[model samples]
Target: MDVVLVSRTQAKLDATADEIRAQYPSRRVKCVRADFTDPDTSAVYSHVGRELHGLEVGVLVNNVGLSYPHPEYFLKAAEDRCGDADGGKAAASAGWGPQLFDDMVRCNITSMVNMCRLVMPGMADRKRGCVINIGSTASRIPCPLLTMYGATKKFVEKFSRELNTEYGGKGKHGTNITVQCVMPGYVATKMSKIARTSWLVPSPDTFVKSALQTTGLEPVTTGYFPHTLMVKAIELAESISESMMARTVMNNMLGIRARALRRLAKEQQQREEAQSATATDK
Candidate 1:
């Protein structure tokens, strides 16, 4: 079995490759460093074709994603980080300007679609392949502060479901291509900012292991058992009253946003003090 690890960080990729090599000495582990945020990511497809040559990719994991530095309202995030969405005003004049949103679109949506485009045809021809897309439980509900992220993940959920229906089967004309959308609630990963693994939040390896168990069983899942439970609870709550659920989630997000802003303010103050102290010493 040949495994290809693609990421923006070379050191991390190398470390992962080493770990995989250690686990399966006979299996080949390859690492490709590519920034999917860039338009140049299209080039990586060409590289894959050249490097893998006649070999078929039996599994493809579309796991690359990007979220906000911290949760905030869509308008606030758009204006503060991606320039003026309202108008070319001073309040939003000095920021990332549409570029951040563009990058997110590329990373979350375009990259996944492009990867499926690159590998799905071959899988169809071979009549065997598995595509696992990492979605989020955020997609299942209406999250105000995490609007854009949730929307993109919803896209993944819908896309994966349709793709599986379109290609997954063992019939005479079946493509035999399996597409699974794994929606995780929370995992103890850098992205989740959860340092400790708890009943609710599992480690990435544990999450993946659990998710893999349901690959051919379900086209869409919460992946981890605990996460599935969490999702079910949320679904139950939503079933009772979606408005109440939305209001409850909105209140929770508002609190998180408040705390994040406070933390940022504190950090900025600390930085300013450090600068002042340095100037005084100078």
Candidate 2:
């Protein structure tokens, strides 16, 4: 199997490629370094094409996405911290500024669309391929603070569903292309701030292992068993009333948002004090 990795950092890409090579010595691994936030996507696509020049790519995973470092009211985030330099970093630094919004859309939505466009035609012609789109539980559930992010994921779910129906039907184009949308609740990842894995929150590898099993069986899946149960519970709760279900989710999210805001505030204060002390010393 040939694995092609694409990301922003060359060093991280090299390390990941090395790990892949070490794990599967027989499999060919290629890495293409490109930042999805760039306005010019043509260059990124061109680089990816160049890297995939020789291989008959069988699987395409549209896994890249971005979210706000912490939850905030839409208006509040837009009005404040728009010009902060720490807009795109991890949780402690990320802010939902206008530029950050653009970057998020480009990274999360536009990249996936362009990648699909670049790869789908070839797959359709060959009549054998798999496209795995990584969506979020936020799309399926009611998430107040993560409004735009959830909206973007909703687009992904819709897009993947339509794409599968159009190209995956054996009767339509006689194609065998599989487009699977995997919406996960949470896994131990930097993005989710999940430092430790548990029964409910499995590791990425564990989630992927379960997700792969449901690939042609379901068009959309929660991926992990715990995530699936969580989605089902939410759906069951929704049977009472949409507003009640939303309120329940929103209330829980409010607590998370409050804690996140506190962490960011404390970190910012520490930075200010450190800078002040340095200036006094100088």
Candidate 3:
């Protein structure tokens, strides 16, 4: 199948395209550089739509997403304000105020909605297509420090389910379009900051292979067996004591947050020392 790859980095896209071409010499691979984090959602998707105008896109994978640099409380995450000229008053009034939060909404939520809008109509006209939305296990339960990220993923889950029902069969449009949401657990990727692959945390290649197999079979799945087990464990914990489970999750996220902050501080100190050494040499 001909593939269209879109992401923020052109170099990475080119590299991925090369890999695909090496694997399947006959298949055509097109790369489009687009940043989903851009606040101007219309322009971003419009460009994407133009690039894909003639292509019969059989499958659209809404894989682009953004998460917290480190797990943090909703309000606390917005502490930096990210150059809010209003002295953060506007963000404060909105309850949670972070440029990062707005970015996450655009990247995680808006990208999916807009891409579907662009691709689904053609799929309906042809009467066939598949949409794969990557969600997260965090959406299944209450995530305290990772609240906004989880909420955005929850939106993905609900949207995929409802959209699937609308077009997966003979519906209003009389089309068969499958919208599947794959809610995966930890994977060894740059986004997850997971360097090593474990049984519980598969590599991107491994996770994608497994998830691809479940395309039309399952509407909502963890994709990997280990991830499914992880979700089941979370379900068990919720059933036993939701409050306890929440506290456990909060404590885990707090530990992660503390370590991330410590790492950031250390890196900053190292940078300062390097600058000082350079100044001394001068």
Candidate 4:
């Protein structure tokens, strides 16, 4: 199976590619620097798989994201963080504090939609493909400080389910593209190094490995550990809220989240300084 992983950081791309190669030595695994945050995000990267490689994309994992340490300044930081991907004029209309919510909607939201749009034509042509969109647990419930971050992921979670129901019909285009949202509770990545102590955190690879397995089942796959089971057995459970809320108990969960944030930020600073020194040939 030929696979491509679109990652923002080259280091992460290399790590994931290495693992895939070790597991499936016979299969081709390609890693591309397709940062979703880039204003010039395009679908051609995905098209390259179908057109150039002579391989059908059996799976697509949309796992790109960002967040602010403090919720108090989330709106303020987002406007500057994200430039105008929607439009120069519409940016002001958004009425967000800085960068129209401090970041580019094009990268965060529009680009994902465009990628899916591009891949669907080919997947529908072949009647096989799976799209796994990595979202956040904040989408299902809510996190006070993670307002916009949560909202953006919520849109993605909702989109994947609808796409599964609407596009998976065999009659329309004879397509069997499985669309599933792979939202995780918390994981130890560079971004969330501050969120070090998640009750049921999985490594990046572990999270992807499981989510990839459930591509064809349904839209929503409850995030975290037992939560994933709760999603599958929602109807059998006594209450919808009771089954899912155990792992992500809120304030208690984020008890140490603030301190972790400080540590991660310090680590980021040291890395930046080291990179600068190296650039000067130190």
Q: TM-score for each prediction?
A: 0.89, 0.91, 0.91, 0.67
Alpha-carbon RMSD, each predicted model: 3.7, 3.2, 4.6, 8.2
RMSD over all Cα atoms, model 3: 4.6
Lowest lDDT 10-residue stretch of candidate 1? 86-95
For model 2, how does the per-residue alpha-carbon lDDT over 70-171 read when each residue is reduced to its tens digit? 776776566445324333222335555667678788888999998888888788889899999999998988889788889999988999999999888677
Candidate 2 to truth, TM: 0.91
Candidate with top TM-score is: 3
Candidate 4 deviant stretches above 4 angstroms: 42-54, 78-104, 172-174, 194-199, 228-282
Looking at model 2, report the run of 10 residues with the lowest lDDT sum. 82-91
Q: Which digits, one per residue and each the tens of the lDDT, describe model 4 over residues 158-183?
A: 89888888767567554777888877
lDDT score, residue 156, model 2? 89
Off by over 4 Å in 3: 81-97, 170-174
Quality of model 3 by C-alpha lDDT: 0.86
Candidate 4 lands at a TM-score of 0.67
lDDT of 4 at 205: 62
- What is the C-alpha local distance difference test score of candidate 4? 0.62
Q: Which pairs of residues have clashing backbones in candidate 3? A: none
